[model samples]
Target: MDADVTDSAGTPADPDHRAGDTPQGRSQEEPGATDSTDGSEPVPQKDAPQDETPQGEATDADAPQGSGDEDKAESSDENKADREADGTGAQTWADHPKDGSASRRKRPWLRWAALGASFLVMISAGAGWWLYKKLDGNITTDTSAAAELKVYEKERPTPVVMDAQNILLIGSDSRSGDNRKYGRDDGGSQRSDTTILLHLAADRKSATAVSLPRDLMVEVPKCRTGDDKETREQFTQFNSAFELGGTACTIRTVERLTGIRIDHHMVVDFNGFKDMVDAVDGVEICLKEPIDDKDARLELPAGRQTLNGEEALGYVRARKTLGDGSDTERMERQQRFLGALVNKMQSNGVLLNPTRLYPVLDAATKSLTTDSGLDSLRDLYDLVRSMRDVPTDQVQFLTVPRQPYRQNVNRDELVQPDASELFKQLREDKPVAVVPADELKEKEKAQDEKPDDTGSDSESPTPTPTYSGSSAADDLCEQ
Candidate 1:
């Protein structure tokens, strides 16, 4: 059985109710109330029908439910207060603290990415530094050998009619170590294996590169070797000047032979030249004759061919069984090969690829000994920058005109009138007007004008003049 129940505030009754003692002093004793003869309290419920209505009364179950709800409300209030005090709720970044955890989480990836980039940069820098140091260790700087050098001053032939410029570019073969296998190692002394002279116009419009034959017989000057303790001065082959007095002596000898002053000089070893060729991915040339020069360890068939370091060197150094089997012919080949090499280097993007170019430069500079001026990086860079703009066509390669010696069959001497005219243009910085047809006419005219068939009255042509200038090591390839 159920009874109508009202809350303490006189509200409507609820559906579910519990048994509770009523406020009035009655036990189902009011009028129209249901009987409880079994002596059990009747539970009040909102859905059940009531027998009597009490004044100002509602459902009793509601009263008890209200007390439990009030307790829950207080607990909820306390939770809200705690959230407000701690400043941590379901708010967004706007309402959160400036240094809040959620705010920090916004750019977590960006931070990680920045850190990773920095780490990679550091690693790259470290690797570069380590590699630089390692490579530096392999370099050997020996000025002691250079100190034993002697400098000689000599009187050179003066140009009476035509002035000429002569530059001697020396590639040393002090191959006392491993350089012997590449070519010959005459145990006499270290000498310039490769020598090329480049002559530019006084106006700087045209240029001619002349390769001096290493086997050419020339009078070498007396040079002193070592200090007072073990000093000795002697006359020897022209190449011996390089070993006796180093670059200074070599420069002096060339200047003495040729009246022109050398404006600049560059020297590089075998490995350096190879590296430069490799950096350019090799050079292309047309080989008309099959070359089988085992001395240089180079063998190649005739045709359009691409040459690497070994083949290029071989092509320049090959003298035996090629052309006229003379040093003069070899110089011609060297000049042509060098010109082709220059063209190839420009076309292959050596300047554009820093990765490939820098290593070559380092290798070259490390293996070089330049005049003091070009020893520094800035100086060398400037020189290269100036030449960088010169077109390949402007660079012309030629040799000093020469013929077999009249007295010595094995030696070569300067060709007469034609050779003198060539030197005159070089010294004056004028274009070499060497059209073959025109030159032949001039030669025929000079021959016809000879007072006697003996040709005794004709003035002998002078040799090329060399430059006597300060040696500045500014053209090192690395710098």
Candidate 2:
């Protein structure tokens, strides 16, 4: 069924020449150019023809097979007549519909279905692009300078590699850019008020979160801040690393202290945590006693209570009412609540449901500043997916070991045995089993209450609160 077309020189047909007698076409030496078909060639007409031979009859040698020259001419005339019998007969492959069927033979519904499928694909692509842009727009990304960040393939005994997985978490009061409208004090004196070190087992089956005291004094490395305009470097509290340089410097300081490479880091401001809490409806906590801390504007009664955004923030941040008024208790409370929060987020299907997930993600994105490794939406998603099924007990919490610092009345020094082992476990990636004396006592008390052990439902001596509102109490229990 293939019709072979050739040019005047008997080669394949070229676009340069066709049936219409354009200037180029008329100049071409077609086989029929020498014979007269309509008397003589028409005189040159400005738009129609110029100096070119007239269309002519075929030669005897060029006639159809098994036919005389006269018969061949007659057949040619009849074919031309048949072509004109139909309407305009000019045709090309494109003239047939895309499915290789003629327009008359195509099914109307099939064409429409194909068009609808194409439209849906285009819409899906556009939505994916928009989502990427929206999420990407909110993140502040940092990648270690490829040339500046040293990479050592040689096996060296590094702290992070020596212990379980270590991750650093920072909570900032930063009010830069759009945050100014939120009425936060993110101006000149911004410090990482809350810092946590997360330790995961070598198998990554469990984790322990340890809080670092913001008020503790530590050797701070020099750092640069501001643009070229207001940049400065100084040594102060470890928390000052954020104010001086930023997350990069803060990461460097923690790495120097623990001798462990932080695999990831996250910072959330006041509003970010608040929005996340509100989106989740709130978190539940069991408080046996009431707390009233004026600095944090907290007031609550003893017993279990569900806290809203403001109350939860107050509970985590208040230091005045917590045990011995020390930062360590505050860290413990933060860890307890954080474990609860993770459980809540997982059970609530925050990751599985897009309708619920987007708001949380939006809040987190707005509040977050991270290293370049976690800059994108995809990167954050992958990290969440990895830790989604980690058991709650596996996510343990602890405090960095410290004791009274001789240099300051209000500061601390790293404790012996416990603190060193803690760092050692982190370096070795081992699990930590820490049982506070009071918690151990409570467990023993519950065991004693078994019906067989007590023999009676009668009352026993009232148990002293291992965690009472004594001088030992930290403000973390306030609300």
TM-score of each: 0.60, 0.62
Specify the highest-TM-score model's number.
2
Candidate No. with top lDDT:
2
Model 2 alpha-carbon drift over 4 Å, by segment: 1-118, 143-165, 175-186, 225-237, 289-294, 299-302, 322-324, 440-479
The parts of candidate 1 lying over 4 Å away from their true place are 1-103, 128-168, 183-188, 199-207, 215-219, 226-237, 376-379, 416-479
Writing each residue's lDDT as its tens digit, candidate 1 over 1-479 gives 43333332133344454555433322234332434446676434344245343433333443345544453343344445565566443222233245544445667998899999999999999997876665444344444333433212234344332323344567877675656667556673566767767775544444567665554555565545543332244434456667666665666566565555665566766766766676676777666678887776789997776788777777777778577877767766666666666666556666556566566567667666665545555555555555555566666665566666677777766666755665555555655532223454676688688776565787776533322111111111111
Cα deviation of 252, candidate 2, in Å: 2.8
Residues 64-116 of candidate 2: C-alpha lDDT, one tens digit per residue:
56645444343334334544565323222233234432332447888789999
* Worst ten in a row by lDDT for model 1: 468-477
lDDT of each: 0.56, 0.62
